[model samples]
Target: MERPPARTPEGSRKTPVTSGLAARAHRTFTPPELIRNFCIIAHIDHGKSTLADRMLQLTGVVEERAMRAQYLDRMDIERERGITIKSQAVRLPWAAPGRDGKTIDHVLNLIDTPGHVDFTYEVSRSLAACEGAVLLVDAAQGIEAQTLANLYLALENDLHVIPVLNKIDLPAAQPERYAEEIAHIIGGSPDDVLRVSGKTGAGVKELLDKVVAEIPPPVGDADAPARAMIFDSVYDIYRGVITYIRVIDGKITPRERIQMMSTRAIHELLEVGVISPEPIPTVGLGVGEVGYLITGVKDVRQSKVGDTITSAAKGATVPLGGYRDPRPMVYSGLYPLDGSDYPLLRDALDKLRLNDAALTYEPETSAALGFGYRCGYLGLLHMEITRDRLEREFGLDLISTTPNVVYRVTMEDTTTHVVTNPSDWPSGKIRDIVEPIVRCTIISPSEYIGTIMELCQSRRGSLGGMDYLSETRVELRYTMPLGEIIFDFFDALKSRTRGYASLDYEEIGMQEADLVKVDILLQGEAVDAFSAIVHKDSAYGYGVSMTAKLRELIPRQQFEVPIQAAVGSRVIARETIRAMRKDVLAKCYGGDITRKRKLLEKQKEGKKRMKMVGRVEVPQEAFIAALSTDSAPAAGKDAKK
Candidate 1:
């Protein structure tokens, strides 16, 4: 086999001589030997996971046929749903075959991250762990909002980005257009972008070669006091916290005593390992390597993400780079659907907390849902992932309420309080309340600008600026309160743009504004967790939609219910769910009494799975489905109708 002669494209209008776009900035470069670290990032459904599977196969980490969908995203929801919920790391062995067909060993540490806006934090976490990134832009879609978001994060981390336009097998793939977009967006020479089809394995080798050539190796004093940056963590049923770290400056071995800088906790290493796809023995991992460090830390609480691992004997670099505690902006309450499983819910959460440091929970009691835990997350996706994990992994049924963000409010006594639970909201507040705001970037085709702007304006979003990507493409920036976009902004953007719009947002800061946490009442009682801090202007419209969605979401029950949205003791919008006029009352079969009781028990169990929004009980799936592009509009329209 011979290397294909590389052809370079000169300008934006360069005609391709081969079947695909030509490579740019082609040069012979020294490949790193001691270290290799890179991230696989792309838009949703753009084959990041499939390419990861190919890398594993080419590296002999896993047999070809065994590779499955989203293998690195091993969670049941991720695998089944075909979306990455968490970032995963795997170390593969690549070899350059000699002329005699022999092989020389090299290492490739790959971090696979989710591409959705909901998981942007996870992408940032993964980017911080790597020195290089592989940007996979869909050939048909060109550069999307999330593609730019991930690329910007990589550039912020000073990581060398090797852009690869993927999905070349499709008939509509415009590789040349995407390549130019990549160069323009990243400010890199167009010749440096690699074109590949992750599905058919075309040009994948060239992409691999570029990874080895373009990405730099780790450089640090190997003999220095041991220090590592915790990027990700997993919990083992038998073992404790299995922390994933990149040995930044020194070597760590099994039984090594280490201190975590964030928590200041001490622990002894129990074992060390790497991701082989199949169980592989631990060969000593040194500086620049990515692997797992198992510790007898009792609980996963001791080993947290962004925490520093250093030698206990001699304190290492006082503070490591990329160490920041994750603050969860969205919070909700989680309770057992069935009252009998209350203890089971607690036990499952405690177990999950051992591995998932992102999820934070505390004891809370709800009048209708009974004993439960109030949980916090980085965003909506983070909250949903935890709930899905609880139900799928531990086989425990859970009831989760509508997510709410923390609000800073002044009381009548002139004291400031951070209110998370709506129950903590003051009944007769007279001073002021503030809500978190975020800077959002939306990318879409120019044709949908009108619809996008109109939708945003209706949601209380203020436009910042609009920049042209090309003649027909544009990027819109807005500074909107997180409260305004938390509900259906993303869904609306996708709907208005026909699934072509992409959105990314980062928390700007909390702002002093006219906002109130309006309580939603279903009957007479308040569902404190369903309360939201909203602007006064849109309160009535949002409230109407809120109850309309609630009416559709709540199951028909034995009792009639009134769904009321209230602000400062006044009802702005209301809806009533009529009581079930017909329910299975009597059984005609001779032995059906036991069967009828079982069916009723199932119905009760189903009712238990709903969230008590004020007095209205809404199903849990309704919350997840509310984020879709289609149903969200129905929720809005039904409210006023």
Candidate 2:
């Protein structure tokens, strides 16, 4: 039998979804008491998505034919990378055996979140919408860095965390050992930590029941005026803007006039629905319910993440605790290959900002790279993914400059100038220059402690301490400059630790350092794109590496070209590109020695005369090549530090 659409009260009508995205609409207004809101948090490849799939199958929301791995990951980039980049929400119907031998049908709002450190902001957003979290750990890998990081966040938010050990069926699975490890951090008995195999679906049902039994229901007043927190939003080509919200008080129904508490802009709700692996229009979304609302808005700016939504008539005077804006840790220059596509890039960024709230950008023009925008991101992975998405989704070819962190340069005049790009460094810097710092945590094998300590020390890291998670696994903590790890630190750590290390970091604050800007000059002319800021000790190495790279890239001219790396007026490193010479003695092989000498002398004089009148012309390709690599360090990698 087919289930009909939800029926509203006699006087009120439920507006239908008109964007052709409407599915079988059977969900009605679920009460706050019966609805359970929670999210899955774990390390990368620790089985969060797989466990979500098992739950979807057991709940019967996703049929057998529709089943697939990482089903909640809806983007091509996500599927190709085999990681969850966005937080996906789906409603599941379940009937738990009640304590009194009765069946209790309840609603489960499951949010599958990304596990990578770069998308921590995404995880935090998911946490705000839920009342509890499922802290998953791999039985074989024990506890990783991200697991602990997320666990702390859940505890901070006061979300009830259910510790789970996944992949218990593996050959090397040590459930007893790791469960005790998790228990140490979460403060519970080892047996209390549930054991389950996401692949075999052994204990997922019991886990679900525990979630319904332990996680407290969200508190709100249904009789109060309508107010919802916009947790996430996306722009659709066919439907304009679709905002995902969690209602904190009252109810939201279709065709109701709503006003944004932040912007005070009024909009009519076109359709209100819940996602049950598909869009299922609901009669109304009451308190404690998580759903999406569409206003038929074509402009993307109106729907902002972390904005509050309330009814236009008799709305709540107070807004819910929304969210604090995420601070960007890295900055890069994103420029279109074609100058005409500047507007298109802007539009793409605006739409992307709706999806990724951590992205921040401002218009910037470079003499070497032309017009572009300086974009900010949470980390290197976030920057890479955003650039990749722009080129693939928008069909725009772009050139990205080297990534760097923001610096606060205090001058002698008691004024401060913040610099994101190297060219912004002032000439007369007399005060302390401060840079951002992060508290880095690394979980690795106990055997690699010596090598890891050496690596961290080489990067100017100060050891915080170390703790043994198990007999073989150790957790190392350090306070390091954010710029040091922005480039190839993760790759280096993986290589040195034999691929047995996991890293996570959070920005703490800024500290003053002895920093100076190094500029790349060709024949006395400074190239703005090749400028970078480095420590006084590493300044010489940076200069030599970059000057050498420029020497190989720039073609040999008629006259000798001098490449120099300078700190203000003092030049630290220099390289000379020898002029291309014409073989004046090739045809005179058998000629007299005096004749050869005379020809060489004549050639030298001619070259000197030409050198006096000729100037070096640096091609655009050379600038592109030099700027593309963040630093051509000793390892010879491009576009990364």
Candidate 3:
């Protein structure tokens, strides 16, 4: 008894609800054996969202006419950029027809995760809420760097992985080749790999059947004490904090008192609900079920991700394992454009942090940039997205300094200090400097291997290994300092490879290096915010390029302005901005020789007075140019600061 696809009502824009009130009103508890908790993992732009959309339609969670591409991507930035930044969860009532023409009702809890390396931590949290994962690979593009990274993460978490090749409708799709690649990576039979086309709705029903048959049901005891895992949280003005969770044991209902094992804060559950693409209030969610809890916890910090929720009366002594705090890799200074907006900026950051737990910041002051916050992020993309959200969502104009990686400095007294801000480099007391390093993996076409190798070596990266995925595609691995890739490595890679290469990296450890703090000085005054840490061997070249860029951006003043880059007390590069000239004798046209001499004398005196009192005003763009390595003029051209 195969059910036909549901259609939306005529002239109706609302998504047709199949199991909202009816499912919640007469909700009989689903047995653990009938529930499947799983998630979809893939590389960026690999059709994970499309497959999820198809699944939602097949289960009649949403009508066909109401469907939109990438339906799980809710944020405006996500939709505009075509990337999934946050993980979304939904519950669907799927029924598979048996041989006897009877239908079996099965509950499917699907979580869609982000594919970017910056959001890998979010993916990990989403995976913890599931018992299995659907590994989606693009048939045309094949295996990518992030695909391997995420596959390893799922394996590490002991989740069952089901390999599925998507986009089989494309003319260039080599399903057999990609299937074999998946088999080589995950150690399974190539024939076992399921193929589906998300765009054409071909082979989707078979894929759904495979999911139910191959994926195991979640295991947990409902009669035991209540315990749940909080994987994500969001802030609401009226509801306060809404926490997305997965029930592991027992059950949770409205008005139940629950305690967060990590924070020990207790709150009464105001409401419990499940997401059917939209929130549907439910009576209770039992073990092996995924849902949300409204506890009136005003601050999202209280309902932390990876925290365990248990009954207040009978709490679990040991919480679930694999809970680790997110560590920020990149650091930058964020300052309000107007000095008076400091308090407003602080409030905005507090509100933003309530929802973004990975963002770390503290009060910091720079002599040049003034009062600001020193913020930390997971990676470069994380930093960009956070900054963009602050400006777009909070309506704040901010100035961001150059991003830097954390460094460990050992003092002469054998004391080790972590340096996040380049201005905080204690050069006098430091005995040795250790910089963070990452193991980078790049997947690209074989034709661009030479170009990529050149780019890697230019960044001071050493080749670790290489592999031939196929005759046309290759995988290259390198161990490089994190700072080298923080600036423009991805952009350069895309430029050189014609956007065919994908990158993924993980921090390996720290190693001692000959590093120095390079300072940019304007008119003999050091700008603390413009200082950066670079390798000693490349400091001179970087200084030259930075000074050259600043020279073009800074405006001329009444007195000559000298832009200099120095390490310690040794100046390595310099550029000068000539003072603006004024013809003081223009008004004395066709006058007597004595009158001309008097005018010249007056002009000379005025010039001396102006020079004595005038201070060169460096524009904001000059500071920005000084901090950006990409702002330098093109090659084979004169670049001076």
Candidate 4:
């Protein structure tokens, strides 16, 4: 094979390729052989996962007939909910070897990351693993908030950016207008934007070719100490922790010993393979190759997403720069719907937490709810998934508290404590308490600007700045507390703006804010499980609404239930659950009476499944749904959370 001459400049060696058997023979490329490691990034429902499916089909990674929308997001929750919760990887052949006898196949490594603003951390982690990004923008919803946020991060990581207009199959998709907007706002030439319909697989091949042409291949010392970035990970019952990594410097195989640089735990590599929709046969992954490594280590204690996996042989020193510790930003308490299944709920979270680094749990006992978990999540979807997984996967019914944020409080002796439960907060503590703040961006059409501003103001959001994208659309920035935004901000924004508002945010840091504990009292007794931290202004609205929802959720018992909303000693509102008035009202006789009595026994069993907070029987969905609603309840209204 004729070798291409080295283009080494200034006292530099040739391109470092990993493989001991292959000598320093220059590898030839004819446009198609050059692969670009890129990730498709977008906001939730912006069609990133859809585009990925189209790309996989166009590149022959998956059969077109077998393809599903968001094919890369394999989780049941993800498919049902239509969101990408975890970042996934897939390899595809970009083109055939050219007629010049060059291998036309370029292995395009594609990483599909989550688009929800809450999962921005995962998006950033995936970005660190890629050298380029295909920024997918909805043609009708051109350059939404998450797109801009992710685009800025890609630029920050020094990744080559290729903007692609997606979802053009929709009649409303305006590709040219979005292309022009991208050129104006994001500073990319309108000609660089590729228009493709991820649904119909239209114009996808041209986009693939553009990816091969525009993005550069991975460049680094292949012979150097083995180092790879653990961009994402998943836990399998059979294989244990499977980490997705890109080999930056050296080869990795099943026999090689490796170490996670962040955890300092060493392990023997059990298996090494690239991501095929179906698991492929074991193959040695070379430098610049993205693949999976499964070590039979059952404990995901140290192996984390965003951690570095390196060869323990050469003792690599410096760790990757972008390793950010996953912090559970939203905290909530969960109890089993049936008291007997408390253990079942606990075990499910423990197993799920192995794959989900963003999930955290601690033992929590409430006077009203008995034993449960004080669990944490990246956001609301994460919390919902945890709860749903418990019920659906583990066969355990659960009752969860309203989610809260961590508060930094300083004691009299200058000791700092991070508090998730407001009930456990130090009373008369002689110092300050700080809350986590985030830099939020909202992109919406100009028609709903007033409505969005009002919604933000209601949630205590302070506007930082605004930029006009066009005469009819605008991007607004706000620095607000994470606690406020995590709840119903997404839903409320969608509702008020008529589903046109797209939101994205990142944790800026913690700021000292005046936050007070709002408690929900049942029968004049405080329920430690239903406490939250809230800004003074919105406390009444949330507290009163929560009280009303709890009243409706708690089924009619043999005795009446009192539900009260209070901040400290001041009571804002109250609701009552009346006792059952018509229990077994019918009079019966003979064998039918026995049958009716047996049926009543089963009904009692079902009633026992609900948690008794005073005289109220609280249902699971009540706690989950009520936490995110943004409205105050109507007088004498019956509602569920």
lDDT of each: 0.72, 0.86, 0.82, 0.72
Encode model 2's per-residue lDDT on 52-114: one tens digit a residue.
999988887876866788888878888897888899998887778666878788888999999
Residue range with the least summed lDDT across 10 consecutive positions in model 3: 632-641
In model 1, residue pairs whose N, Cα or C atoms come closer than 3 Å (at least 3 residues apart or on different chains), thus clashing, are 24-191, 24-192, 25-191, 522-615, 522-616, 527-614
Query: How many angstroms is residue 190 displaced in model 4 relative to the true structure, after the best TM-score fit?
Result: 1.2
* Superposed Cα deviation of residue 219, candidate 3 (Å): 1.4
Candidate 3, residues 112-151: lDDT per residue as tens digits? 9988888888898888888899999999999999999999
Candidate 4 runs further than 4 Å off? 1-34, 96-103, 262-264, 338-347, 410-417, 429-432, 550-563, 575-641
Indicate which candidate wins on lDDT.
2
When 2 and 3 are scored with lDDT, the better candidate is 2
**Which ranking of candidates, highest lDDT first?**
2, 3, 4, 1
Error of 1 at 21 (Å): 33
Question: Of models 2 and 4, which has the larger TM-score?
Answer: 2
Clash tally for model 2: 1
Give all TM-scores, in the order shown.
0.80, 0.91, 0.91, 0.81
Candidate 3: residue 40 lDDT (0-100): 95
Lowest summed lDDT across 10 adjacent residues in model 4 is found at: 632-641
lDDT by residue (tens digit), candidate 4, 1-641: 99654221111223322222121112222122255688988755678888888777665556555666777776687777677777877766655444475745577788899876557777887888788998888887787777788888899999998888888888898888889998996675898788888888898888887777778888766567777877766666555777778777666767789998877899998777665544443546677777777777878665676667788888578876646667887888887767787777766776676556667899888776678889887777667766776777678866677677888888788988778887677766647888999888887888998998998887778999998988888888988888877755676777788777777777788898887778888767887767777887778887887787787676677656778888888988788887564556265555556678787886666555533533444655665455432232110011000
Relative to the true structure, candidate 4 reaches a TM of: 0.81
Q: Which residue runs of candidate 1 sit more than 4 Å off their true CA positions? A: 1-32, 96-104, 261-266, 312-319, 339-343, 520-532, 542-565, 573-641
Q: In terms of TM-score, which candidate is stronger, 3 or 4?
A: 3
